[model samples]
Target chain A: MITVINSILTILGIYFGIGLLFGIYFFLAGARKIDPIINDSKWTVRLLLVPGAVATWPFLISKLFKTEKQ
Target chain B: MGLDYQTILWNKHKKVYDKLILAFMLMYLLVFAGLTFTFNAQTTIETLIIRAFGTLAVIMLHIILAIGPISRLNTSFLPLLYNRRHLGVSMFLAAAVHGVFSMIQFHTLGNVNPVYSIFTSNLDYTSLTNFPFQVLGFVALIILFFMAATSHDFWLKNLSPSVWKKLHMMVYVAYALIILHVFLGAFQQETSPFTIGFLSIGFVTIVSLHLIAGFNEVKTDTKKSEKDESNWLYVCRTGEIEEDRAKIFTVDKERVAIFKYEGKLSAIHNVCKHQGGPLGEGKIVDGCITCPWHGYQYLPGNGQSPPPFTEKVATYELKLVKDKIYLNPEAFPEGTEVKPVNC
Candidate 1:
């Protein structure tokens, strides 16, 4: 369990670090002219989908995992 | 924009930005805390749900970080610079969560503790692909935490601006390390070629934008210095300054705005302390140099504030040599150190 977990974390650590670096460079490069038009556009909408999906994912996955009597 | 209109927009937009970050932080904590209680019932499906939320928080932080230098290089972006520490704190919280949750989900439940296993289980850290990437996250989080902790106006007021700025630059170094960490660990683990392409584009786009902006800021500073024209003595005759009026003179390549009013001559730095607006184009309002651009009022005699503000600009020593104005370019203490100049 520890090995699997450590392996997963190792991946995530890099994933997040890369995102941060990407964002930093993005900002620095566009500091002169970029207005972040796309980024600022209603991120809340994307965030809201999380709770909705969280509520539904378990329900959908549970049914598939259930055994049926023949 | 008019002062009142700018004021309204400034306040409204500031409120929206602040609330967005704060509300996001609150939601992250609430949902992540819920996961802790529901840990016993957790599954891969649940972990994926948390990951989705984590991704959302991370993107918002990127946006928040992007807003700073973007606004600094452009005056229009001043709204973002105003009280930006709140945004920093929010980013810290989001990054901290990313660190903690990954630790719990992947490492903590194992036979040995996650922290121990991370260093021990990981193969050759010396190798590029099999690096202990979580340590990078830990270090980055700590840097973010320090920045967030010092993100108050109190620190800005206490520490010199130069010192504060240098400390904040550490964020860039941390960010770079994080990117490398992810490139080696996360993308490697997922083994998704598509993710690699997407991450490369993201990195490229952001870096290019910043490089361009940084270069632009450097150019702006150079241009300002080169544009200055100065003369030994600019003879704008004795009555050049009328009561409540300002006259601009170039002395030793410095723009000196001399104001004459009520049989008195007052000379001050011709540039507004706020954003270096031209004070020569300004007016004397109630004994203060009222900047035309931003309306930042400065007293000509000593450059002190009317009250509740301490911003000041350079002042010059003036002398009427041969009935013509002979000015010394040496600047006196800005604001409230009144030295009499015989004019």
Candidate 2:
């Protein structure tokens, strides 16, 4: 059970990380401009980072180290 | 100038959070019924307290998320604008419980170092699947701690609005971190689709509201920018303004208030420096422009907020362009001499 949980956590971490990266890209690319309209795209895209980083945790654990129980 | 959005949302959301905190206490009663039956007497206390705090966190998250939209729908909600710090601090106090109790329940004692186990236990910061939810929580909590500590009006009085606004914007960063923490740390373990869907819906609703508000602001500002003319020419005679009352004029999206005191005419931004209350209608008290709402006093010549509150507003260049009394829309530093409109 511990091994299975750990594997899942590893996947969540990686998947969320990808989302976080994408959110960051959107934030950086759109946040600053003379025209404030550009910032909206950044904030909308940035919201994705929260759920993405969160969902990837289980997968992240599996890749980081060998699960002792596995 | 008017009350900018940062203050507006801050105000309305505060009332929402106030009502939210009160409502949260009622939920505390329902949970107690379950705790009494399921757990042993001692474990009941621990479990109830810990879980109750988690529920409080969830409640706070919902309130914080909801505040952005409720405030946008109304204008009278502006007074809540001044008390935003209290709301934020209250939210932090609620979140603190989850922060401390989680440590004691899951990570304290045993063979493992509490701090080390936080990063190591089932979380891999480097791995995509388990990239360390606890660390994000840790970082989020630290930022919350800083924000709560500095939420005092004392800080607002001392720090420039630009500096203070920049620091407060970190709440968005903290929110993102907390979002990840919950996803990996809690929902991952529970595996409840209902729970996951609820949280996702909550997040999406909030982001959509903020985006809509942002767009609304863009549209409003664009309209204002277009309507306000390049120059405002006034036909004021030399002694048109009086000492007790201010003559209000609009130029290039700026509200200019001309105050005549002791034979000199000084032009200042009509918006109050403290809360953006209209200064034109405000009474001149003790030789200063006092905001009617909060009594924020500013020296008219310099537009500087008086002692104990460091605030300022833009001062316009006053020029008598012709007998027609032409006023330049361009503003100058406070206390500097500019040509005046004799309209």
Candidate 3:
């Protein structure tokens, strides 16, 4: 039971660690590119997006790249 | 509106609403603390903190759940619905506090990691009475955290309203977990009549409100309007609709809002682009159909948001034959301008 719990936590920790790194870049640059309205948005709005970005980084990453390809 | 972004589109009303929330929370905590200290002198400060915040969070969750169906039943309650996300986030914050304090006080004493300890501390999952209630709470807190984190419009736009709505619906799951957590953990520890009665009342109230609102909506959905000679579905007489307001109809299994404004009638999707709010319950404010939930505006004629705002809803064609209004059941593309029928 302990081993399974530790494994699940370790995987979650790693997943979120990668998400954090990706989230920083997405908020700083990728967000504006994906949504033009975000270009002139306030710093507070960008800050507000950080946690959501970190939580859902894989989806945002796909969206970011898709917008770039276009 | 997806035109611009701010941390919060703070208005004077929102500011007042937030201030009221803070005041109520403080008042609740103070009263709870006073009662606890007077009655339960033997209880330690940590237990008091955990119990107080836990009960407060449960109360807040009940209020949050009730707001949706209550607003549906009475448009007068729309103002409460407008700032409901703030209430949700605040509930999550209170729940997180309870969760964190519980972890530190109970689990941190052991050598194992606090989060890990939550799951393994009680392995008697088969026993209903001896079930690990803290695990239920911890899972519920994670769901609440995800919800609170994505509560902003930024997430709404990015995730798409449908996806975001689905994600937010996890609140029901969280609510269930919380009810179990309180029942099995807190009630088991101290079974006071007042606590049990209060919890029962809160649970029944939320469930009843939702069921009533849902049944009323199902009536609308099941109402059949047969097509006339030209295949135009029969709608209510022009007199049935009030100026600046809409009468919703279920057409082709989709809800449509037909609005009477400026002596002309227009039809659009009943669902708001922002948050799936019922646009049919909204009024025409400043000549735009304003959503009752968040005040997202759409021009009644074109089903489009005014310039700089990009949100839109599907429009339907309305035909007036004398005093009886009829609608073409087919819908035009979103933001399509179907000339309003003069009544």
Candidate 4:
């Protein structure tokens, strides 16, 4: 039972770590380009969105790096 | 934009959308319940409602997600996008019914709180086959609750559209969790090939639709242009853009909409201030560029909303040489009064 609980804790830690990284990237860079509406959002509001930002990073990444054709 | 908010800001179109949703949900519940009761008379009512609403919620979610890409790929499907929030809220209601009933039936009457049992009773985290599926559903439900709670324009305004949109994008996370919930819970208990096949087909259909729409957008974004000068790029001929409409061009990674209205031409950032909707897709309504997504209007020249509204988009300089439209790749600060050129 202890082993099962430890395994769950480890998995959750890794999951949240990845989510936090993506969330930080979204806050620093992707938010402005992906959606201009969020450009002036408060820091607290931005922090609240970390979990969602992490979850939807795949779609947001495509939009973020999408550049204009010269 | 109104001061007071109703339970639902019902209009003729919203009424129609709600009627269709109700009719579909009722039809689905009746058919599913009827079939279950007929096939297995011994199945309890709680189980029947759980299955019926669970399936309906998932189906509505697929429809909700599909509507975005479908509308983007084909403008004819825009009506579906207009009242999509109602569909999302309705889906959450259905899922809530399923979740509540399932909790009452399975998790209640145990030694602990019903909600507590949902997480604690299922402790087989290491084993994929016997994983805690209810935990997945619980997490998904919490996400859906937040999404549904903030589905109104009031929240969009208060939270700012960017934060609201990002928060709602958690629907994809909820979707993944729901998929895992069904696969691990029901699929394990019920080995019916029909159920498995149905879920697989729905998943494949959603993935394929998104891919097709994404590829189409990529084609638009990657369109090549001929540069005429250092900061100015050639857009298209004057005749190319229809009166009261726009010809959107991507220059230096920024989208610009060149509009022709009343024998005058203007260029502005393609992205709308509201919800990042594509302003180019909108037409001139009463001499202002009206966003198709929500009818948020902005003057084409200065890219500022009319009096009493403060929304704005960046404007660009436009010049006509030999009937060809040339736009400056550099954008002016938003709401700069760049006068429209006579065409």
In order, the interface RMSDs are: 15.6, 13.6, 1.5, 8.6
For model 3, the superposed segments whose C-alpha errors exceed 4 Å read none
As a TM-score, model 1 comes out at 0.55
Cα lDDT tens digits, model 2, B1-343, are: 1221131223465577667655755566466546655664555555666667655666566666556555655645544443444566677877788778777777896687564566567645457556777778877876776667545333333343455567678889988988777777565566767656767887888888788878865554344321115455562655565675577676654577876665556678887755456777666787887775566777777787766555777776555543323455677765454443334
Give candidate 4's whole-model lDDT: 0.83
Runs with alpha carbons beyond 4 Å of true place in candidate 4: A1-70, B1-4
Q: Write the per-residue lDDT of candidate 1 for residues B1-343, one digit (tens) a residue.
A: 1211111123566678888777876776567556655864554654654454455544554565566557645757665655465576666766766677787777887798676665666656677676777667766776776566445332333333455567678888777776776666656577868546766776776677678788865664343221214433444566666667777765455667887766667778787655465677677787778886556788878876566666788777666655566565567767645554444
Pairs that collide, model 4: A68-B253
Q: Write the per-residue lDDT of candidate 4 for residues A1-70, one digit (tens) a residue.
A: 7565557656755765776687798767655555555555555555545545665555556555663321
Q: Model 3, DockQ value?
A: 0.67
For each candidate, what TM-score against the reference? 0.55, 0.59, 0.93, 0.82
B170-255: candidate 3 lDDT, tens digit per residue: 99999999999988886667777877788888889999999999999888788888799989899899999999999988997789
Rate residue A3 of model 2 by lDDT: 65
| Candidate 1 residue A23 C-alpha distance from true site, Å | 33
DockQ of 4: 0.04
RMSD of 3: 2.0
Residue B342 CA displacement from its true place in model 1, Å: 15
Q: Which regions of candidate 1 deviate over 4 angstroms?
A: A1-70, B1-13, B22-46, B72-74, B110-117, B224-301, B305-313, B316-330, B336-343
- Which RMSD does model 2 reach against the true structure? 14.8
DockQ of 2: 0.02
lDDT of 4 at B178: 91
Docking class of 4: incorrect
Model 1 docking grade: incorrect
